[model samples]
Target: MKAQPIHTIRLILIPFTLEITKTLMAGDTSILQQLGLQLTPYWPDQEAIDTFPKIIHNLEKVPEPNGFESYMVVHRHSMTVIGDAGFKGLPNTEGEVDLGYAIITQAQKNGYGLEVAQGLVNWAFQQTNVKAVTARCLLANVASARVLERLGMQQVSSDAELIRWKLPKPVTQATIK
Candidate 1:
């Protein structure tokens, strides 16, 4: 697959491509590790992710049905795996879409998170007939808020469990190059 270019007002974030598998079988662990990200499906090492079983279960289905997807975001110059960004489902009632992403710790300071995140959002809005994209972030995660804001999503509600933000419609469009 070719690289994709994402544009914001002052910066441009590039994407590596979309990759999905039951496990981190073929990807280079060291390279992904240097990017400050865990190739493991679950955030923290554990027995296993509850969702892992489902992911594996759905592997056989081509063009994954719904609420399932993944992608890698690569930095333009370095060509490094800066982060993993993608949506989980096609879309749900009320047009709510779930999104998840994380940048390697080493690549955190740069705007790659925002750039790639916006790219994901733009892609999602374009691919599906959805009205809005939603994400849940920890209230303390300022970095997450910053990234969401860059993608044109605003905080709409907050609860004890999560900080919710919604992207009504992506005004910025990016295409894979």
Candidate 2:
């Protein structure tokens, strides 16, 4: 079955299919138009291109629901592809998953990062066996650190080069008599 699209406050997270990834890797915008998504000039960045091979490999090994791959982040208002974000892979034996996100340069500083991160974290926690989400960023990426912090993630570890953050699943209360 095809993966379902996830909706956030201002964006829609659509899982990337092999065809779509290939088209994106080729720097084709026709696919976006065919998909009825608006075109944005900031996507298909070098990082996204560099990561496609890994993404394809992962997808071939473990398909959706089992594989954590990149999702195209589309702006709800403009229906444009703004960037990409997702987990590195399925939750581990410890119920922990790694998260990654990037908003195109044009879309940066617009709070889309926070919204996407929060939405992904919430979705992960809802999945079976997922207890926490973790993320790591370069020490110099203050913007990314802020996004993680806004998601209520705490700094679990850090070194001179990178900072690791994690957010545990939220508690749900049961009604009592």
Candidate 3:
């Protein structure tokens, strides 16, 4: 089954399907119209554009969107595509999935990163097979590191160029009747 859109108070995470990925790569904004989404002129910035092919590759791996691939980050009230976020793929043998997100420059510093990351992390942990969510950011990207830290992800490792983070599933206690 296709994964459904994930809704948060101020944003909606719409999973990228093959059609959407192709349309995006082709520089066609008509898909946005069809989906009732608005696009900012600054969106699909170089970084976001560069990730399209990878997103398409991931989408092709499954018959449909499995919620483990990329998603368009749409602003709730404006219905605008402000960014993109999601996992690299389904959970690994270790039950861990890698997370990634990028907000358009115009939408930066507004907490959208944290909001979307929280939503994505929460969604991943809800899956029976997901035991941990992982992410990596450039060592120089302080803002991105802040978002991961805000989500309670701990620094698992770091190299000269990148810092890796991990958030283990939060344990929950069963309620007694």
Best by TM-score: 3
The lDDT for every candidate, in the order shown, is 0.58, 0.83, 0.92
All candidates in order of TM-score, best leading: 3, 2, 1
In model 1, residue pairs whose N, Cα or C atoms come closer than 3 Å (at least 3 residues apart or on different chains), thus clashing, are 16-74, 36-104, 36-105, 67-88, 67-89, 68-88
> Which residue runs does candidate 1 get wrong by more than 4 Å?
1-20, 23-68, 170-177
For 1-177, candidate 3 gives per-residue lDDT tens digits of 578999988999999999988988899878898999886687778888899999999988899998999999999999989999999998999999999999998889999999999999989988988989999999999999999999999999999999999998888773212
Q: Given candidate 3, what's the lDDT at residue 95?
A: 97
Ranking by lDDT: 3, 2, 1
Task: Note the residue pairs that clash in candidate 2.
Answer: none
Candidate 2 whole-model C-alpha lDDT, 0 to 1: 0.83
* Residue range 44-137, candidate 1, lDDT tens digits: 2221233444334434443433323545555545444455555665567776677887776766787767766766676667654677888989
Residues 73-175, model 2: lDDT tens digits: 8999999888888888778898999999988898899999998888888788767678889999999999999989888999999999999998988777631
Q: Cα RMSD (Å) between model 2 and the true structure?
A: 2.5
Write down the TM-score of every candidate: 0.64, 0.91, 0.96
Q: Lowest-lDDT window of 10 residues in candidate 3?
A: 168-177
Off by over 4 Å in 2: 64-67, 174-177
Number of clashing pairs per prediction, in order: 6, 0, 0
